[model samples]
Target: MIALVRHGETDWNAAHLMQGSSDIPLNDTGRQQARDAGDKLAAERDAGEHAWSAVVSSSAIRARETGELIAEKLGVPFIRVYPQWFEQHFGDAEGVPVEEAMRRWPNRDPEGFENDEQARLRALGALEQVAKDFDGRDVIVVAHGTIIRSALMSLTGRELGFLGNATASRLSQGAEGWTVHTFGGETLEDELGEPAAEIVAEVEPA
Candidate 1:
């Protein structure tokens, strides 16, 4: 099983800013959230459930710090940093407020912005690589919300809304391909396919 964990919240997150690719450290609440996640994972480990073999993290500072804390709590040996797992680059919108960023770059086409499709592909490829490398072992991945959500969209073709900080999702591989079992602790029962019409309509046009 592969568990994807979004990093703890940062000040930008609280400010409702577009934090794409901006290196920000976790805030006090974020640090506590990381500790809480670690405690939960540690409890599961102690109970002999979901024993994690390794912890992997995005190269970003927030994600790395969260991963380190979880690894320490879970007694995992080391963390592998994967740069490809980095969040989508929001270009000029990087530190801007969310509403303004959306208005300015509705289609995410601002200069230097990473295309949504490309970001999705990168996120999928990174997870696939990790799945292959750690086959048969339960691994934890600490990454950003956008990339993680992008990966889920690639799998389910659904417009899953923003994932909360420190939340986890589970993905598993089978003969067909990768399947999302749970997202933010909610178990998914349907097969992967195009998103619902309402969901598609709700998304702002690029």
Candidate 2:
């Protein structure tokens, strides 16, 4: 199983900014969210070692910080910079409203990503490399929403929407390769544990 957590909230995320590959620090609420999630994960591991064999995160400042904090809580080690987990490039839509930008140019990444197909291919290849690095181990991935979403599509045979901010997506060992327990969003733990179809809720910067 993989505990796929997204980085905490950023000012850009709060403002609905579309920051593809643009680094941003977490706002106060984002910090709190990470702390809360970390606490929950810690409580789960109170009995013994965490289920994760290893933890890895995007090298982005926000994601790295989140991964480090969560690892600290889970009693895991190693917080390295991994570029394969970076967010998707939005091209001309770098700092605009994410939804608005998507509406302006909703792309159908049938055989490739939204921008620079070659770069997208490189990113996919790198992701496979990182996954291979964690071969035969359950892992934790702290990354951006785009990366998390993309990974879900790759891991499972399903392509759902982007995750709600700071939410965790879970993939468990299943009859088939892997299965998505939940996408990123509030109420995700319950959703995963119970396997229900509820609307994904957003928890804003508090």
Candidate 3:
């Protein structure tokens, strides 16, 4: 199982700014959110939800801080960062407000911005690396919302909206391939534990 956790909030996030690749630090509320997320994971672990072997994060400061807080709470090791898991590049619109960017770039794709395909490839690559390095152990991945959403979209073929700060989306490896079990607080399974929808794509480890 790989738990993809969106990093906690930042001032930019509150202001609806496009903070791609900006290296913004988390705010006080963000820190508290990270701790709360850790507590939530711990409680779930106590109930035998899953055993997390390690915690990893993106290279961004917010993600690193979130991973560290969660690691501290879970008593798990904080592993090295993965640059591939960084948020989608917003290009020249990095510091602009999302609405204004959308207006400026009517198609909502700014110059030099990473497209969906590229983001998906990066996300898949990161997951493949983590799976191989962990040797089938469960891991927690602290990353930005955009990249995580791309991964979820690639696997589920559904555009899951923005993931909340410090929230977790779980992906489990199965015979067919990776299956999204939890996403944005919604379960992708029926009461009998069967997947509600078939996975649209299977990612082969590189």
lDDT minimum window of 10 residues, candidate 3: 189-198
Clashes of 2: 0
Candidate lDDT scores, in order, read 0.82, 0.66, 0.87
lDDT of 1 at 171: 76
Whichever of 1 and 2 has more TM-score, that candidate is 1
Off by over 4 Å in 1: 189-206
Residue-level lDDT of model 3, residues 33-138, one tens digit each, is: 9999999988888899888878999999999999999999999999899999999998999999989998899876778888878888989999888888897788
| TM-score sort, best first | 3, 1, 2
Give a tens-digit lDDT track for model 2, residues 1-206: 56778888889988988777778888888887887777776675675645665668887888888887777777788446678778776667777786787777677232223554444454455555555677656677788877676555554434456576556776554333455566763343353454444332221111
Clashing residue pairs, backbone N/CA/C < 3 A, model 3: none
Model 2: lDDT to the true structure? 0.66
The candidate that achieves the highest TM-score relative to the unseen native structure: 3
lDDT for model 3 comes to: 0.87
